[model samples]
Target chain A: MTIWQRLRHTLRHGPAPLPAAAPSAETAAALAARLDAAAQRRLGRSLAIRHVGAGGCDGCELELRALNGIVYDLERFGLRFVTSPRHADILLATGPLTRTMAEALARTHAAMGEPKWVVAVGDCAIDGGVFKGSYACLGGITTLPVDLVIRGCPPTPWQVLEGLRALIEANATPAR
Target chain B: MSAAAAIIRAGAASGQRPWPRHALSRERWQAMAAALDAADAPSLQGVWAEAERVHALFLDAGSPLAASVEVDGGSYPALSPHCPAASWFERMIHDLFGHTAEGGRDARGWLDHGAWATAAPLGPRQAALPPRVGAPEPPEFLPVEGEDLNQIGLGPVAGAIAEPAHLRLTAQGETLVRLEVRLGYAHKGTLGLMRGTPPRAAARFAARLSGSATVAHGLAYAHAVEAALGVAPPPRAVALRAVMAELERIRAHLDAAAAILAEAGAAFLETRFGWHREAMHEAAGRAFGHRLMMDAVAPGGLATDLAADGAAAIRAALAALAAELPDLVRRLDRSASLGAGIGRIAPDLALRFGASGPVGRASRRASGHGGDARLVPGYPPYPVLGLDVPTRAEGDVAARLRVRLDELPESARLLRALLEALPDGTIATALPAASGEGLGVAESSRGTVWHWVRIEGGLVAAAFARDPDWLHWPLLEAAMRNGMLADLPLCAASFGLTSSGVDL
Candidate 1:
């Protein structure tokens, strides 16, 4: 297909109007400040991330992996994914929340330490993309509080990197 | 031609205290228990609960054939033998339906820990309760430990990635001693999702269970429904299914090749492989309507048939891939670092686990189950065309890569063959509703994926989809021994085991 055709396809199937794209919560300057501070004290902001499967085709996982690859390189910013909920600084949930996994999600979120962030990545993670409730879905990460939502059936690697960058940026910002 | 006869002979050779195939229900179940008691079958392959009964398939150590036994749900809660693999499925049956395998030990549940109001899933003729939130108390994860073994835990989260599973790897200074895997972080009750979703809709759900094996799941689900209804898919549909399977195979192999490069630290090679995989996915999306082929196949036929333009595009993409893969593999073979980075394990491990797909093939096991034999009902036109079976002897991770490398070209060749002769006929029209229990199996890229479905008067009674992961996960544990800790990721990538596929 030609480039124009590809663009048209995206226009036709792309996610619902971005809902104002959730205005950036923090500026680059603030993000830089926190990074420098973390570096100075030798105590970088520790992020214990939780991966939630709301309802998705795992393409989100692949793109998310791409962001962590050598190309996008997420570790450089000192953010890391964690196993235990008690240790989490962010719950990086995916998929559209299903009825069965709902309790696990709620408990996992409640288990996280203070100053938590929930970022829903992917169209399904945001609003149950391809699997919009035939029988199993309860809907997106909104089943719980979501600090950020990235849209796309499975967002691109760049978008994944951007969303994480926003989370760190937002964390450093003073609540308005 | 006689799957039943082949199974009986293979069973006796495997030393299963054999029961004649025509034995009645009680007679067969009792005989199977006796065989297991006699240590004739070393492993219980799997079990499925349909209607009010549960059937168990068993195989003796190194046996080529398998035997099955069916017992009353009430009787089962007490009579089944203590086979490890059978344990999970039994517990699953109990959790969903309320039936127990008699004398089944541990009694610990799989995932349904009294979370739902419904009775055990298979015990009830129809579903009773609404979806529930939590299993009673989460089962205590069996902590893995030994003298002075440093434990490094990975996942549930490692970054922004969405794959969910908490892996506890116990090792002594990077040499892994034990791997206790905790799966189901993403288990959304997909099997449960299939309970009544018309097979057409259910196939879509199955397709999404694992992104990589979408086509496999789609075909397997379709096949189960087809068999349940006893309707053979059309000739064109069969031809198309083969083409799609081959396409899925080559695409996955390309991804595996790229992953091998990534593990070997060959940056350029890795990128080349990644691009190829993307190109394949794109081509697939254009041809089959879903990049992953989700919802393509339906009961007795196809939901969507291949269009001429789509077929032409797929052929073109395949031609390009076929041309490029040779040079790419040649580079990998010549790279000393990559060759050294391949798995260093023994073939014995792969054998012990009965690993399937490229892993089994690399360990020198037959990779392809003769397709023509599986087309028993002649639904797909597979009997008309043959498939290439890839094999290797090293059984190491590198051997797995080599198997994939060889298979990649073969898949492309298959694509060309299928496309050149793409049949012109109805994909499928319809079939009568299933009147009894039936079994359906598809040769997925990984290996044979089976779906056992029971239809009672036209509605789905139960659907049990089991992928090759049953054999794959165990082999992964076997492969990890004696490798350096960093190499663990490389090892896993080489195998690319899917937890979602396994958990279901």
Candidate 2:
């Protein structure tokens, strides 16, 4: 596929969808275009991020690692996964937020500085997809007003890209 | 004693205690923990107190005949039990729930340093408070102080591809005397998240707590549910679960081996081992759902059967990994830095703690469920295939790595055998008509991973899963003593600690 075609394709479908999966190809394409835009905008800026989960299958977290893999290279975008809340800008939360992790999540979220966007990735984060309102987890974006939601148990790398794509776009144009 | 006999005997040793290791519900576990307060044995992981019941696991390692005990610490400050291994877990429990052990050693808290003001909790029920403005400042952790030695602080902010741990090293110049640790910077509060999810779906949550050892955690979680519900998995499923476990074991050990090689500074040899592990993971991704093999097992059986071609692919992958291990071993042997400073660390302390996995095996404690016990239920097939294996006596970093490297081929051999004898039967059993509680133990790549489950009206009431990281973290702190600051990451990564897995 040509680069333009690839970008268009990503903007629509997100990433390569699985056999009979629910997400649309165009959505994947759009998500991809967005992810690209997010990274492109932050070419030289240093960003610190922390991943939090209400509760999840953990597939979402693993996919986040791909951001560091040879292909995506989150570091190239100057994105760093920091251990201390002292050095984080964006708090990336996944999972459904089990009762066990509720305090930890709140504790972590509270520790971050202002200008922080809480990105709730995956279906679990969007609305407790697989683990819907289980006693352990309430639901993401609902429990804590989520800034952005990427829908998928584990959103695809490009959707993660696109969601991130949407992230920077939102940052560029503040909500009315 | 045989593993089962040993278990029964171990249970008998603590017969005098009021909690007696067999409580099933959150209330019972909490009551048992409260009862054991003065009886010795105290430290908790994941304090979950809800209408369902309250549950947490207390670790007591001072007496090995009764190595560690899991208790339910409920209302009323319970009596305390603190072995060095329980250090990380206790801090975590205090951070989550208001629960506190009355007089445990090292009562200095972990996560709940008044960092967050919203009731400092893990909850399904809350006051529905609006998002408060004016952020609360995180409390500074109490730094260790002493005149006898200088304190060294290691990473809360560390290098990428590394987990965060703060090690306070006390030493006189270079010769180390003591190492105190401030853990839980990576606390995710996962256990608190499991409150209402059905036992089946919650099993997936456990599997991902750590990136590696996915199979063991899944199996343990599933087994806990199965036990609590009085369910038994299909025989074929049991065999399959065991197969996946050994597959995970082989891969985890391979990863550790590669790290050891890298730590020993043998880039040439390390790269080869690293590639071998990568190749193994690729095969796993093909055979299992994901490379880390997350959520592949459930209470009834496996999430899905490994397809015929997938098994064939895995068998081939195992063969490939086994083929390269011998050469990898020879290269690792040539690495001049194998035992960087083995002299200073106390080999005796690691043994005394009842350390499990390669760490224990290296220290002269006969371990490795497959090689040492002969009763590692799932090895007739898959990575451990028909084989003659052996353990070593060095009990140091090098020895542990060697055990893992040696175990890799054996796991491959077992995987090959499993493929050769693939059975035709249901992959999962019907859920049993069980209620109350039951426990399950699976020897993970690290060591024995335990899961305690509580069920009521066919719903999960409470479940506590413990990883060997809880048992080994303090020992790692102990090992850091006498070793220079440079060896911190190398020593830690060599052990391949799993923070989240141990946290809950």
Report the poorest 10 consecutive residues by lDDT, candidate 1 chain B: B14-23
DockQ for the candidates, in order: 0.17, 0.08
lDDT (10s digit) by residue, model 2, range B1-504: 323223323432322121234224333333444443232233232233333233344333311122233333432233234234444454555556544545545566675433344433563333442433564445344464556667666544344434444566667777566676665544455565565557776776677666567788788778667756656677678667767787778767766765666666766565555555555566666776566666778888888777656787777766766565565566566664686455223444554454666765566533432223223322222333444555656656766677777777666666666666767788887674446665555668887676666666666666667777776777787777667766665677667776556645
> Per-residue lDDT for B252 in model 2?
70
- RMSD value for candidate 1: 8.3
Give all candidates' CA lDDT scores. 0.62, 0.57
Model 1 alpha-carbon drift over 4 Å, by segment: A1-59, A62-92, A98-139, A147-176, B1-27, B33-45, B57-84, B103-107, B113-138, B143-146, B159-162, B336-354, B365-379
> Model 2: runs farther than 4 Å from truth?
A1-176, B1-82, B87-97, B113-157, B163-178, B340-347, B366-390
Interface RMSD, candidates in the order listed:
6.1, 7.9
Tens digits of per-residue lDDT, candidate 1, B1-504, equal 133333344432221111121223455455445544332344444566655556554333323233444446355633345344455566666665566677776476655434334445445543654545554565455566577778777765442344555677888986888776655555556666666646665676667767777777778777767655656788888878877887887877877677767767888677656766766766777887766666677777777888658877787777766666666777676774554444554554454443557766677634432222134223355555655676777666777788788877777876778788876878876767546555565667676576666666676657777767776765666667666777777788777766666555
After the best TM-score superposition of candidate 1, give how far the Cα of residue B319 lies from its true spot, in angstroms.
Answer: 3.4
Q: Identify the CAPRI category of the predicted complex in candidate 2.
A: incorrect
Write out fnat for all predictions, comma-separated. Answer: 0.22, 0.03
After TM-score superposition, what is the CA distance of residue B439 in candidate 2 from its true location, in Å? 0.5
